[model samples]
Target: MKKIKYVALLAIVFTILFVTKANAQTWNIGFPDTTKVKAILTGNKLVIEGKGAMKNYPRHKIWKDSVTSVYIKKGVTNIGHHAFYDCRELKTITIPDGVTSIGESAFKNCENLAAVIIPNSVTVIKRNAFERCTSLKAVSIPDNILEIEEYAFYECFSLENVLLGNGLNQIGDCAFRACHNLSSITIPKSTSTIGEIAFRECYNMQNFEVEKGNIKYSSVDGVLFNKKQDTLVAYPNGKEGKYKIPESAVVIGNSAFASSKINAVRIPKTIKTIEGDAFRYCHNLSKLKVPNSVEEIGILPFANCDSLERIKLGSGITEIGMYILSQNENLLKIKIAHKNLKFSSKKGILYNKSRDTLVMYPRGKKGSFMIPENVICIKKGAFEDCQGLTEIVIPENVTTIEAIAFQYDRNLKTVTNRSTTPQKISSEVFSYVNLKNISLFVPSDVVDKYRNTDVWKEFGQIKAIE
Candidate 1:
């Protein structure tokens, strides 16, 4: 059976490679007149020698699977897109100084394409240039290049190190998605925009050093200092169990520790901010202590940490990011030192623990809910997907009904709001429930105010108190 399985798998792989080759119709490398090169596959390397003809390498037509490592003749200048894409056996490529442009997806999805040396002469790198080369351990950006287009080197899961070229300015979105093995990166001074999710879902990347801070950007240790730079990040820089961040460190970039294996962390007092997801999804993480200087905790800062139950947020923290502590099944108690907390639930708000208004519930709780009136706003999605919640009530002083604030509750039904003549209503206040449209009681005098507004009309028939 094993032999048969292996044979079948090999057949499928060959079939796919053949299709990729079949679809690869006469792709040109340098353009103009160039002899067609034949694919010479020997052992693991695919040798294309320009047939020792044309006085140069073929500018057009390459067999994508015919070669594991491409050797360009001395005169080649441009390497076409997807020319060597998905060459699993490809390990290394040496692009001589002669090549100038490396087209998009040129070496993309080449899982085994490990080492590459881009010479100084190259200038433009098109989109999806080096995406998903899982085994691509490391590569250095050429200082001469001006831009690295979108989706460059994305999903290089095994990628661990990158040497940024001096002239680099922009890093496109999802550029380093799920680079599980990537440990650290340095952002040079010339870099400007670290695009959205530029490092999204990088599981193993722990620390970064930004030499020069961006005009409006910042960095922590080395992680992209998220908007609020107060939070600092430190992972197992080496395979150690204990670690501490220096006081000089400011912000802990988002997702900096999303998937780190650290058991504990101590955030110093110098940190004034903690970006969202700074320590998110730290599965093995068990304890955290935020110093008193931290005034804000960004949204979902500690979400999805299944093993985490204990965290210390000092007195200086004023605002708590929305769902910051959500889904922490082990979290049963949250001790807040700030008495005058101003927790705002406005517009699906991120809770401001610094305000000292709303009381964070213990991880495990039973039944009815009542949000104090002093709490000025109720954040959107604050209690989303809370499997334990059943019945709840809101105080009258509350004003906004944050979008999707109370959606996706399977058993939660019937919420009574006490806001006598509070503010306007928003959409999706009560949805995804099997029960009847739960009533929201508002003073009859102000029902007109909410009813007239376009935001509250379609959600589910609202009723006013007489």
Candidate 2:
């Protein structure tokens, strides 16, 4: 009988300890004046009763992992920055109607958060507010919101339905980038600014619909454009096959065709400018012909085009950006119109009009190559990723080799430099090349010069030309 009584006493003491620990988990969420607001964690629920905005919490808040649901009372006015960041287990949140803003990264990386009620009182959704919320399937932005900041919904893989409020005025850069399931979006009339790459990499997106009476933008056949339709703002990534640029379009906006499914594009003579990354990552694009009306080409316009075999540049192109044709694994040739006074092409290699500066070496070109006798300098990344190059001979006239000029030429085995005096170059000029096994041949008279140079000295074998 005494043993039974002792066991009962032990059970009572354990129960009391458990209750104390549970009560200790409750947190005061407001400022020093705790009387105004309080937050309690009971079981899987987070109950927040407040009269003002909650304080921002660091990424590793104690309750982030345990809370599966949140209920904010109507008196709360705002959701502070990073308030629930990385709350991977949070599945639902009831936002009160009086809240005016959702702070930056307020719910970022909450991968399991599937449902959230954004009340009509919110005026702004700060940057990265719901980024990486993979389980969120739909969102309806209320009519009172004014802006959605940069990267607000980036990489939200499951988001399929988005209803933008008529009062929204701006969509910041990359706000909805990489939202793969987002199939279509309608821009309300009140939206005046849609930032760059906002819808890039949305592989299933087929159209961008703009409401009528929009003063700043318009849409034609599901293509987004400026009010006058002279600038092609964006091309639906899901649109396939050949597309002809309208004669009225004078410019191709930045990233307009990035990661699109289009295989071919016809450029009309009216196009005068091709902005940066205009045709980047169009894996199916095989060939292109730039018309004579185009005068400028922005940075990396044709980079990473896996199937791009040839490109013909028109005579009017006076400005060309760096690495414009880099990383194109299948690009075999670059043709420049004879009338072009600034650039030229010879044997498929790009060069300055005077043939003095080697601009870019076709990454697809195979076998050995001899630099032209007139070439004096090789531009940065001129021969980057030329995987098939087994040998290269630099002429006597070459004086400079820029950074990364021959990087990643893993197959390169021999390099013969004809200049008696070694050209000064950075160590990055031949990055990733097998310097320990490749042979370097230099003029018999100055083999010692290459043997002492910084980058050249690293080559495995230094031999004098016979």
Candidate 3:
């Protein structure tokens, strides 16, 4: 009976001691003070943990200068703002599965971080999470991650590759700014919106390979490789000079050859569309031969070509761009395959040989000018600024004369036509300066044809002077 009594007494004392300790147990999260928690440096790394249940890892104010790698244990779900910010040497981090959200500036300016693996349970990664991590090379996002917030990977210089998550839908603005080493990148098909400046200044970015017909802009073999049927653009690496693209290529991208030195070019028969600045500022390009397959021409495609002297436009082309041959003063000839076609200019006129448009004279030649026998029409401004012209003759088969065919001309005194058919003449044929003293001399049988038409309206009466 005495032994039983002693055992019961000991049991009661132990139970009292256990209850007292449990009542005093208060939560202490990692913080500056021990009462709350302690973020102490154990050697090289900083360790943070919770002291009690309710005070589970308080959000912010962590990572002193000595911190290297942070470990968010099983209970950490919410990491406060700027928690591990600007820790330059923090190379690696492993967040336990229970951790969910990472706050803004959480891993900002961690320059030595090479790579990161986003956990599968993380739904959202807040703003500037990995901003300016210059040493980071690549990152792979988990399949469950839905959104990556603003500037997450902004200015990550060494980030060369990124594995997008399946669930990821969008990339925030300026997400990958100034990533110089990123030579190639592949964006996932599930992504819908890529924010502005997301891939800006990625100068070395050469190609983007995606699902068929998905990417709007891409590159192939150091050439602009777009799958959208936009255009096959080629850019010269060292200098531009005499490019011979196959006739089968189409479309030229904007600024593909901006500010280059190409002296001459031979465009093939396969080209269909020429975009803006297709050949701008090609300072030395003296001549261009456009094939018959082209239809439409864009502005400044050949602007400011100082040495350009001749261009042979294709037969099927309809609309001509403004200033297509601006500032090409040395140009004295243009050859086209169509006779009934029209061309405008400030000076030179279109000379027709059979169905082909022939030479354009800037300053009309003096002495004798012979029109090809099978010529059809003479277009506007063809001889506008030709002040030196004195004598001209129409060959046996000449027919049409457009507006200002001989405009802004002086010292022209005589014209002789051998054409059997009457020429369709406009009143402004010689209206600019001096057709008053000029006389119309026609074939004997064609006297009535010249008299009836406006060709000799401002000239002296036509005498059968053939």
Q: Each candidate: how many clashes? A: 40, 0, 4
Best by lDDT: 2
lDDT of 3 at 87: 83
Please report, in order, the local distance difference test score of every candidate based on alpha carbons. 0.63, 0.91, 0.62
Q: Model 3 over residues 169-208: C-alpha lDDT tens digits?
A: 7777667656766666565656655554465455455555
lDDT measured at residue 153 in model 2 versus the true structure, 0 to 100: 97
Q: Could you tell which candidate, 2 or 3, scores higher by lDDT?
A: 2
lDDT per residue as tens, model 2, 127-164: 99999999988999998999999999999989898999
Cα displacement (angstroms), candidate 2, residue 368, comes to 1.7
Rank candidates, TM-score, best first: 2, 1, 3
Tens-place lDDT per residue, model 1, 1-466, is 9999999999999998887666544322234445543334444455443422222232133355556666665556666666676676677787767667788787777777777888887887767778888877887889987777778888887788888887888877667666767777787777876665566566556666676645535554454443445434334222335556666667666665666666677777777777787777777777777777778777888988878867766777665554878777676456544442553232222246443234345344456676766666655665665556676777776766665566566666555556665456454644565435445555667666555656443325566644
Off by over 4 Å in 2: 1-21, 31-35
Winner of 1 and 3 under TM-score: 1
Worst 10 residues of 2 by lDDT: 24-33
Which window of ten consecutive residues has the lowest lDDT sum in model 1?
Answer: 51-60
TM-score against truth, every candidate = 0.62, 0.94, 0.42
Q: Ten-residue segment with the worst summed lDDT in candidate 3?
A: 51-60
- Candidate 1 lDDT score at position 156: 80
